[model samples]
Target: MPVGSITRGTTNTNRLRRVDRWIAEQPALRHAADPFVVDLGFGASAVTTFELAARLIRSRPDVEVLGLEIDPARVRTAREQLDRTRAGDGHFPAGLPVTFGLGGFEVPTPDARRPAVIRAFNVLRQYDEAQVDEAWRRMSARLAPGGLVVEGTCDELGRVSSWVGVTAEGPRTFTISLRRSGLERPSIVAERLPKALIHRNVPGERIHELLATLDRAWRVHAPMSVYGGSQRWIAAVATLRHEGWPVIGGPRRSRLGELTLPWDAVAPV
Candidate 1:
């Protein structure tokens, strides 16, 4: 039996684009011996899995995507969609390397093949904070050497999102990605943090301090908004790094309204 409960199964096309782009840049996928990825808990549609494969293939031609759902019904639905996709009845390429299966945190793969990356977006939002560690342990254990598990949540439209990158060693980085054009505040991501840090965004928590400081930096750089949101975002992130926030990445990423920090910087106290 699958090791998880049925979620709402809510999903939309291109809703996971930000994370896909980030994942594409990671060495785990780019240099994986198998270049296989698991889209754990893909919901009502297989479109995101297809999209992930489509995006990843550019970096790793042999990239194969497997969409997994704990609910047999969702799995069946995704397989049907995959059939139409293969038949060239959909917008996706007929030869897209994608598949669908029924599984959970156990992350079952044929021949017990471990994945280089297990993307469990929005899968943990409905779980208790206490359950996060165990889920991460179970999922990360299924990763191939040097592999990582990307677990996080995003808004329905995918405009606001945040995730944590976890490896066999443990959580390594926390990232926030947003639509820069009309973003009101970087802290808007607070609502979409992975379950582990969502409830931890209260006073005295390191995550809370990080968000509050980011908001301050954004406000200080509000004048740059006239130039463009991306410019303002870049400036805010630069300020964070200048002030010893342990931020990762450079202008290339901040221009996309994305900022990543070592997990220790925002880990719960």
Candidate 2:
């Protein structure tokens, strides 16, 4: 299936750093026998994809990263740039191995190998919520068993964001990433969550309930304000887990202003 149409082709160098960082941490990518990450909808510039490759290599140095742009022109431009970068000198700026391809969510490849990680950041925000499930299904289906499909959105400056990690089976986890000091409250992530849940952040939806609960806990931990926003967020998230939100990760991620929760905690209402 073609799956969906191309997006607005918008992108920035660090636009997806948050999600890429999470991808680096995922056991899905860490434990894969052959990790190939797809930068679906890489937009007019391929810098972000290059950055993603560098980031993933930090966690899994042998990882292969491919930048896939729906627009042929974009792919051509990216390939040209990569050609120039590689032709110039023995030193490519980022030093990470990378490739560019012309393709869409179906993730075209003549080799027919499934991707181990598909990082579709900012690709689905323009889509309807109804389209998300199908899109997730299609992308997830292209994953090798135990692989991951990470779909997410972030602020223009890469300050705040959220991502959903889906396996071939379905969504497995949700991770919110932010600049701890720049955030007013943990709930600020509501605006950056994937399209599937951003609109669902209301009265009865599970996502809505999660954000509401986070807000309440943030208030409950207001006294931590004396320490700083990061401390406050840590306290707030601790409260969420205490209240049974299925918090899983340790402080390695927590220190980076991230919290990973089991999918059940915020499963759709």
Candidate 3:
């Protein structure tokens, strides 16, 4: 049995697109010899796992994706869905490099081959904050050298999301992604911070400072919104970089309403 509880299983097609797109861009998956990826706690539907495999295959043809869920019933349903797809009764590509399994933060694999990347979105939101470190440790231990653990949360529509990228060395970077249109403020994403940093968003916290700074920058650039949300977002992110936030990526990523910072900048406390 897996070492976690069953979640609400609330998922939709492309509900994880932002994180999946980011994962496909990562060197951890793109450069692995035979990249094995895990979708930990992959809800009731295996569609996200299927989509993950589809996106990654474009970067690494040999990439394999396994959707692991703590709920046996969910695993069985996903297997059945895969079966339907295999039998030409479903929409997914037949025989894609995907599988469904039962596992949790421990990340059990049939052949015991460590995976190159494990995506655990929305999995830890149900646990107490203190359990996050142990869960990260367990998952990171199952990673192959140079592997990555992307853990975070996203809205039901997948339009807004945030995640932390952890390696064996510990958390490395934090990212915020949102749909460009109707973005009220960059700080709106603070609500979706990963379990490790959610509660720490109070006074005197690095994450809080980061969000406050971003809000200030957004206000300073509000006039640019007349042109477009993307323009305003790029301006705000550029301002953040100028003000020494160690923002990662550049105009291209920022134009997509995404910003990344070194994890040390906001690692709890």
Candidate 4:
């Protein structure tokens, strides 16, 4: 049986753009022989799943995307939406390489083909924090070689977001993404941390310290905001890297309001 409960079913067309862009850049998806991606628990609508396929195909033209929902009713709803799109009433190219299935953390794909990348945004937040590891294990076990599980959450409208990159070996990195322009402070992303580190954002925890340091850097670089939010964000991230925070990515990514660090740097206590 599928392994999760129904989520709030809340989602929008571009609600997952941040993560989708990040996933498209990953070597796992770009280099796979037959890239297959899964949008796990893609809530209410298959819009994000279709969006994911559209974005990924730019890197791997033959890429296939599957939208998996544990709820049979949701699976049905998504299929109906797919039908509409195929009928030319929607924006998607007719017969886009996307499908909907009934499954959960188990990630049951038709023909049992392991996916090259599984994007599980906003799914695990519904589970108890303690269940994250097991869920990760289950999903990772279904990954194709060099595959990844990109799990995270984003606020409504896709502005502030965070996700952890997990592989069959283990969790690799944590990334925080903001909208840049209206971003108040880096710490605002704390609310969207992936399930593994959300509760660990309390004082004394590594994740907490990481956010605190970023917030401090943001404030210190407030003057740079006069130039632009991107400059301010770049300066703040540069500060974190200078202070030996293991910040990953360069100006190109930083200018986009994204900061990534090895998972070890912010793993839960």
Candidate 5:
């Protein structure tokens, strides 16, 4: 457990805003009486955890959030952040619910209370690819029924990202979100894929094949370049659906440089 010294303990103000927004829109946590979310490996600061609570409370007012960190020092740092942000009314935009605790993948709580969402971004990136599946299983096993585990990576600036939406049942979907400008290729996000699929971005891998398909579609849709990158991405996604990629959602999400697909389409084969 203490094999690694500790993570770099890095975090930003709104590093995870997009994932928070997406989670807030989901039906699972919308009606939860005391829907609890956990920010696993919250690094040295729990700002994003607080931000997640602030945003999600708009939809599920009864929700509470807890930031979990493995490093004792990082936990102390998060406690300090809590002290600074001290939530009451204006702590959040409109009085959101939030809190934090110290725990690991085991969640180490006597109450045995599993959370509704466990967000672990940029956490597993430090581990080898082989370690990903076991880590995911260990964490997801601690989720409440219908709970989700969002595991992924993002660029330093949070512009381009990809994550896996895993439920207690197993992994369900994969979503890639990006900013539209200066984006060379949709596969550029391959670099941001979760640990499970990052190294799998090679020939003979499901994700590799999928990204290659998207790249080819992007090239084929190059004629639509004048319409804007978003439009070109939309066309490329359409080509994926036509080729049986099991793509989900419509132009609404695609317009925002997002592409969602069923898990098996890109699941490790």
Candidate 6:
């Protein structure tokens, strides 16, 4: 039996593209001996899982994706969708390397194979914050050596998103990715942060401070907007680095409305 409860199963096509792009750049996926990735709790559709596999296959042609859901019914629905995909009746290519399964944070894999990457987006939002650590431990434990667990949340439209990169050693990085066009503030991501940091975005919390600083930096760089949101975001991230925020990446990543910091920088206080 799966080790978790069923979630709302809300899903939309192309709603995970931001994270999928980030996942594709992960060393774990790029360098894995077996490029097996798991899409844990892929909600009401297998479209995102298929999208993940499609995007990744461009880089790692041998990449295989497994979509997992705790709800047996969702699993059946995804499998049914897979059938159409395999038959060349779906939008995805018939040969897309993807499958559907029943699983949870335990991340059950076939033949005792450990996945190189486990993407558990929006799954833990239903779990209590107190349960986050154990869930992380469970998911990370099922990773192959040098494996990664990309767990986070995104809005229904995938415009605002944030997630944590967890490994066997624990959470390593905190990242927020936003669609720059028409984005109001970097802090808009507060509502979509992963369960581990969502509740912590209150006064006096490190996550709160991070968002506040990001918003302020964004405003301070408002003049750069004439150059485009991408330039404005790049300036804001540079401000963060100048202020000693331990920011990662450079103009290339910031232009995409992304900011990554060491997990400790925004870890719960």
Model 4 — which ten-residue stretch has the worst lDDT?
1-10
Q: Which 10 consecutive positions of candidate 6 have the poorest summed lDDT?
A: 248-257
Error of 1 at 31 (Å): 1.2
lDDT of each: 0.94, 0.83, 0.90, 0.91, 0.79, 0.92
Q: What are the per-residue Cα lDDT tens digits for candidate 3 across 32-126?
A: 87699999998988889999999998989889998999999999999999999888887678979889888888899978989999999998988
Model 1 scores a C-alpha lDDT of 0.94
Please state every model's RMSD to the true fold in angstroms. 0.7, 2.0, 1.0, 0.9, 2.5, 0.8
Compare candidates 4 and 5 on lDDT and give the better one: 4
Superposed Cα deviation of residue 134, candidate 4 (Å) = 0.4
Candidate 2 collision pairs: none
**lDDT, candidate 5, 60-177, per-residue tens:** 7788778877887877876766666554433544334555666777665437777888888888888888777777888889888878888888887788788999887788999998
Give the Cα-based TM-score of candidate 1 against the true structure: 0.99
| TM-score for candidate 6 | 0.98
lDDT, residue 193, model 2: 86
As for candidate 1, its clashing pairs are none
List the pairs of residues colliding in candidate 5. Answer: none
Clashes of each: 0, 0, 0, 0, 0, 0
| Model 6: pairs clashing at backbone N, Cα or C within 3 Å | none
Model 2, TM vs. native: 0.93
Spell out the clash pairs found in candidate 3.
none
- Return the lDDT, model 1, position 1: 93
Residue-wise C-alpha lDDT for candidate 6, range 1-269, written one tens digit per residue: 78988999899998999999999988999999999999999998888999999999987999999999999899999999999988899799999999888898889888978999999998999899999999999999999999999999999999999899999999999999998888788888988989998888899999999999999999998999899999999989999999989998878888788899999999988
